[model samples]
Target: MATTPHAFETLKLTGLGRSFGGHAALAGLDLTIRAGEFIALLGPSGCGKSTALNCLAGLLPLTHGTITMDEKRIDTLSPEQRGFGMVFQNYALFPHMSVERNIAFGLQMRKVSRSETKRRVTEAIALVKLEAHAKKLPGQLSGGQQQRVAIARAIVLEPSLVLMDEPLSNLDAKLRLDMRTEIRRLHQSLGLTTIYVTHDQEEALSMADRLVVLREGRVQQVGTPEELHTAPVNWHVADFMGYRNLLDVTVTESGAEGVLVSNEDLHIRGTAVGGVTPGGAARLAIRPEDLRIASSEDTGDGLIVAEVAVVEYHGREFSVGATAKSGTTLYVRSELAPQPGDKVRLRVDPARALVFAADLDAAGEPVAQTALAGEAAT
Candidate 1:
């Protein structure tokens, strides 16, 4: 596939919001997308990622705010008038139509010349490497093939912006991985500006140039994959970004170097974030891979002594579940296999640990003091 020309210089969303029956599904979404950039909307279900995609696609009307491309407002336009391509999770292909016909449908609807439509469709089919399957009906093709047809259909129109709403959700795990590569390749080869919606953190981190994490219809954080993974803005974002161990602790010391937090029987130092204050309650987040069994004679300042409850082999390493003396459960990945009932000293580098202000309830009390064991806080 050859690189297509760049589209608009910038697409801006100002206070972009959508509501359903007085309940806001997306609100105050302010973002500026540069042309030819791949952006992913990442979050768990009901986080308004899909709502934001739909609003961008013109499938849903905005409750408030505006969307503009290169300073030209487009929120008031119709879906067709917006001239953006959309690929849905279900593929949304016409079962009765052949792959070629499906790919040609949009061009046909636009009243493109017969010769031009056929040529564009041929190019699209080749671009997706589906020339052999072009004559096959949607039901006759595999899930991955059907998804390629959907992609071909969208790209044939040469739309400036492409919107995808969980497009790989229906595929099998292997197919999802394969399609991730395929979609990324096409986006790059086409020089497309894409906004993708997905709940999968790995998918977003792997494919997008930048990620926008949403929660409860609000933007939580927006940054590159490395930025979010290395330094999540809050505990919630940390939990979503694969920081599987989140423990409640009280900050004993805070400084430019970081913060030292402690719970009964456990004291750890971690990078302070979200304005953690000394003597205040905080949440400590550590990724499982970063937490490992400490070597003998390698006594560390933040050593956590735990009794291994289980150890499962993960081919490359062992996934260990342990209970600290403080009663907090911890998940760690280690090269050394520690059997159940074995006592181990776990350690995490201060750079790998993150501490944030504790989430507070409406009553100003710390919310859910228990740790999130091998799972994100939801």
Candidate 2:
């Protein structure tokens, strides 16, 4: 297996997978990441995003795969020999070492001269805007500072690719947003090939050049942020993208422009742009913001009327939930601030709606990983 030297070409994975006993962390997954690309590997916990990253980073041996860098194979190389820098979620800096020393450790391991190490350390500290804190130990720095130190150390080696595994998980919300901007700026200024592993939707959508949505050891969809948002391949992705009003409907024909929905009683017209099969079990997914509320309205060609059951208020928005006349539960986002027990009609735009087949186990179940996100302080 030969190694390639730069990130300006495609890094390919063919038949990549890992299996332990009867379970597979990743299975038969293939992807091609181009040089200088910034990709976010996004999925729920235990969904194989990390497993794929470990395989690509050479930290985990493949059960059956070939990794190619610029068309040359490099699957057998050790992690260090793969020439990729990594920033782990824990900011894995040496606790006793100063920020500058932590940044210089990789160069020191490679037997760089003391003078060169010092030069690189200086450059990295400047790049991360932590020159003033270079003398502090990991214990003495804030979580964001430590994360930046870890990032500086990773880039100080000038590796062709960088891997960040939930690097901002430890920071507070405000700090995470600040670091997000910083990382995006740094990636832009440097043009390094970066693979960011994250479960946070906003982080992935706001920062990534593209997204690779994974699920249960399979690649669900790969595309730009907008593409995934506007046209998800299935119900899981639509739900994940915040389309909470997913109601059952039926398509009468391929050429038909709308759908017939309800408990087989009501018929509603919606977009048929998603290549749905006629007379098939179809789900209409619409974003909460795409739905509107009214006190009175009649039967129409492009509207869904439901009775409000609950209304929750936040500072900037209100979330309303109701069961439509068709017995389908729906949630909508509104600024009007309706209250529970209020009788109101809901209207959702057809253009913003999505159609998908049901995948109950894969996409319908609520992920328990929300608890893990809350454990970031530990």
Candidate 3:
């Protein structure tokens, strides 16, 4: 990592889009990245996160948009000319080259002086704590060590911005956690502006200053982790953020605080989002952890009485799968264990629940949503 803070201003993307034979891979991506800020592009597969990253890295040409760095246009520049360092998912290391040589390759190609190249390579190795493996080839290093070399190779250039595409996806769970800390430490120590792309919501939440959620080649929402976790802009984003129970219902009332929605036998009041209106069809989202087992003595207006269909002990608590009288499946987490076919009541804090307009299909019809109760456990 470099010792000095980055000196660049904001990097702006206006209507950034990419198309492949008329199919839009990325569309209308408008974002401003400040110097030394860590931003994460998060979504599931085929959600255009990698496409957005490639466009920023200058590896992909824009169909219609502009990329500006410090008020200067950079969209027309080549990858090397833009001078942005990138770390790929597969580690992209030279198998025959030693770790030290791999880190020095970029400097050598740039025709930097031999003394400067050696000095920077030494510093980069020390920055990633790969001194012990400097002389080893890529083939001899573990997956984590290879990833460190890849990171070192990128940071050795001391570029103003760094882009990482799922760099830790290949590592084991423990290594992934360790590298998350390492990456955050490096970003802070070097004051490097970073754009990280990951499908893992936990990884993005833990490491990014802000997160951009994408769907079908468009940006859905951009906010801090807390903002996105507590108040997603729509149902698609809420589903991605771990709200597993989605039920379709009709809105009975709407107000400043939230809205009241109900089906045949169940009624719920939750925070209204995505322009939900009274008398309109809507979807309700609830996290299993937020849905708790109601005690026998507990009486509430928002109680959801159901019959438990399955229960699994998850170390700290039990995950109960229940079906309401209306045939809607519900998943809830509780400290108490309940057997199958047992009658129970579930309660959710209205503040923690979310409600959005019903999703539509290609024909513009409201699509029926189903809740897979098993997903709450994982």
Candidate 4:
């Protein structure tokens, strides 16, 4: 009896990049996927998440860097030789082929025995629970069913790694949830090393064991959903990962006694950024859920007196929008319904807040705004 190798052993991408017409798409994309780890590549549109995936799949040529699977560099390998299973956003199902035929195609191409292909096809159809749809063509299947068939076809080869690019984007909300659960079930059962690319924050958070968040052809943050949710390292990440209270703040005082200033009214009593001078631009960020509307009687470690401007109610909780006395917009989330024009104090847990230096370009935005205003008045 032969033992099986790990799903993926230390897959690495070192200083990877790709460029088109002098515009770099993927740059310095260094990533390490542990054996059997499911990692989601996440970002907004044009951030190169898909480009990185294509690089891994060998569908696109790399302009720089190296890729290694188990320390055996496969940067020169073709897609078929690399043995990566890819499920594209569009499903990529062959319209004329039946589901079973699609599942068996890879095995047939690899010249597996006919009887073995039949057995594997049965198993694959059973895995996706598409036994009834086995006789149906891709054209006859629903979007969700077609996606399942695509997944089955990809995995039937028993490839070491699977790549999915926004595979659920075409499905309805209910089917998306179902597919999410199905994919998780498949991941848990098969333990296939999977690299998923998606722009949906909720999908990535719900499905991935960890995620690589990218921006501007570079990695911004990489962490599990909980880690990213609780403690993103910087302002771009904080804002991208649903941190609503990411405010531009500067240190008014420093040393053992540090006071952080935002707009004006909210004076945070803490060393906002260690090893940072008072004059430098910085950002303070927190999730909207972490902030609270303090009652008139409440006194807390992190309270910013504010007024309710808008109230949006969800069945489980409420999303509150407010303005500070300093004119900074504040967002608070709670179960209570706050009416328009209601004055409220909000508490921000300082320890839970994340701060980082402002990007030079972003830091200059206010000055540009002021200049535009001056120009408009003149």
Candidate 5:
């Protein structure tokens, strides 16, 4: 459906950093949140997603850097002065106030006239589809309903930006999924410029227009879900994006199609985002789903002999754990659920397997072949 256009310009966070007594929580985060864009700040715990959100909400002081909205500096503004709406993980609605009152509290605090406050509160409730529960207190509502109310309260102010910190994290799995759709729909309808901080990969991938993946207070990769999933720039990002099989391989040959890499026990040719030259050390990244497992009798050009370690039934397919002849453990998802200790052949599409520089700055280096392998038995 067509929706109203966004009113604001871009919001820029430049060299954003927050330090506490010589220890840095967020270090030099630079992002440009375009108007009407939904950006998810995604990372594991302590990756500075929340810290960045807090800084944007004016809840935390920036140790360094500036925040600009429409080319106007606003990092020094207080939370109220910034006039941004915030939704917390725990629904921070007033226990004593009804839904309408909770949504109208901001307007009341701003000393808005009663008629305008009522009109805005009505619009917000309708936007969240909480019109039926307008008179109910937060405690009387379900988790999802309460969260809708929280969202209504935030949007009632008609702020230029909206900040959400794991807003659906408190709900059950199904509720979280439902809210993901709801939030995305509301975002488009309102033409909101939102900054969502979420550690859940699925949530960020499904909702955000773009994702900023963070690790150790640094931006690892910023791209669309498909870009991050299919082409991780580094081993750490590959790992984070669920590239479970990471093998150390030395480049024995390089060509236009891809590079040929070899380990002590196996040699394979694969592609890399960056050029991998001969006589260079690199790590090969392969997703479990991209791996093919079959009987040794199956004819394949690049099959590697392996022994199945375990198999796990994942509803649609089986996740098989196996060790290559080179002793590199890997996980393979297949329809044929191979039993434990079964001798098999492992194969991968040359294009599906990605290679990264060995010295690439991974979040944490895997110590063994099984370091990132999945353990499951079908």
Candidate 6:
């Protein structure tokens, strides 16, 4: 299917800030969206991802800063004037209207000619593979099919950009996966620049070209999926990215070998990429998969001696919970199952761990923001 050619100007956001009741919901955000790139706004609930999306859609007004597409200012424009397509979690289809009519609603609102609207709507239904159900009402279709109608509605206008807010959240697991593929396929075929807001890490990581992680109304980190997964800026992001263990330690040494960290009963050398001065407080972040368990007889240098406290089998592997001599709990995943009440030594490769300096935010708490700033400084 052919789409109308777009002007293809980059969308630029600068110092985007939004507040309600004098409380900041999004603050000082800067981003550049390439003409055809897919970006995800990812974070936990209340992390301002939805707020950012609404600001872009002009559904909500920005408290400060500017949004631009090429040379025109867009932050001040109404939602319709922006001419960007939007899909919401609710499907938002008119129950009384047929799929084809729903898809034609936007074009009709814009005073497009009836022939042009019918032509675009037909292409859109085919684009989403909903041609067979074009005359059916939304209620008669399956959840996934209804969502396709919503997507068809959005794309029938051939808007310059597309914004989606948790569009697949209502679907079942299998359906969600199927729709993810469908969305990616549509993005590629249409060459649409898209900004997707989702709390699910897998959705963001799998679908977006780049992801922006938000926290407490601030930008925490922005990078590709592999970059964020392999090397998170700090403990917060590491935790969000599925790093199961984050241990508090003091930096004993920092050099080419790595950042050596030591606690009461643990010593680990992790990646030294983030800032960590020797003799300073730091945090060591490692995934459960990276931690291995060995018997006392097989112990090596720098092994963490701990007592197995719990064991859970997960088909292919065992998730072992162990307690160190210092009473700190650690989790490990191993193919070799271990029984509870067994003594074990934990081992982690230095290259598989990440260490970050202990930096706190204004509330006197450690956060991802400082970790990103520390990395930037390095």
Best TM-score among the predictions, by candidate number:
1
Report the error of model 2 at residue 8, Å: 4.6
Give the RMSD in angstroms, all C-alphas superposed, for model 4.
4.5
Q: TM-score per candidate, in order? A: 0.95, 0.87, 0.92, 0.88, 0.88, 0.89
Candidate 6 lDDT over 220-294, as tens digits, reads 899999999887886767867877787878889878888789989887778865677898777788899999986
Q: What TM-score does candidate 4 reach?
A: 0.88
Per-residue lDDT of 30 in model 5: 91
Rank by TM-score (best first): 1, 3, 6, 4, 5, 2
62-144 per-residue lDDT for model 4 (tens digits): 99999998789998999999988999999988888899888888999999999989987898789889988889999998999
How large is the C-alpha RMSD of every model relative to the true structure? 2.3, 5.2, 3.2, 4.5, 4.3, 4.3
Give model 3's clash tally: 0
Error of 5 at 15 (Å): 1.3
Superposed by TM-score, candidate 6 places the C-alpha of residue 310 at a distance from the truth, in angstroms, of 5.2
Off-target runs (Cα >4 Å) in candidate 6 are 295-297, 307-329, 359-378
Regarding lDDT, does 4 or 6 come out ahead?
A: 6
Alpha carbon lDDT of each predicted model:
0.90, 0.79, 0.90, 0.81, 0.85, 0.87
- Ranked by lDDT, the better of candidates 2 and 3 is 3
Cα lDDT tens digits for candidate 2, 239-275: 5677777666666644445554433423555666455
Ranked by lDDT, the better of candidates 3 and 4 is 3
3 or 6, greater by TM-score: 3
lDDT of 1 by residue, 288-341 (tens): 999989889988588999999988999999899999887778999988888899
lDDT-wise, the better of 1 and 5 is 1
Query: Which pairs of residues clash in candidate 6, taking residues 3 or more apart in a chain or in different chains?
Result: none
Candidate 1, RMSD to the unseen true structure: 2.3
Backbone collision count in every prediction?
0, 1, 0, 0, 2, 0
Q: Where does the lowest 10-residue lDDT sum fall in candidate 4?
A: 367-376
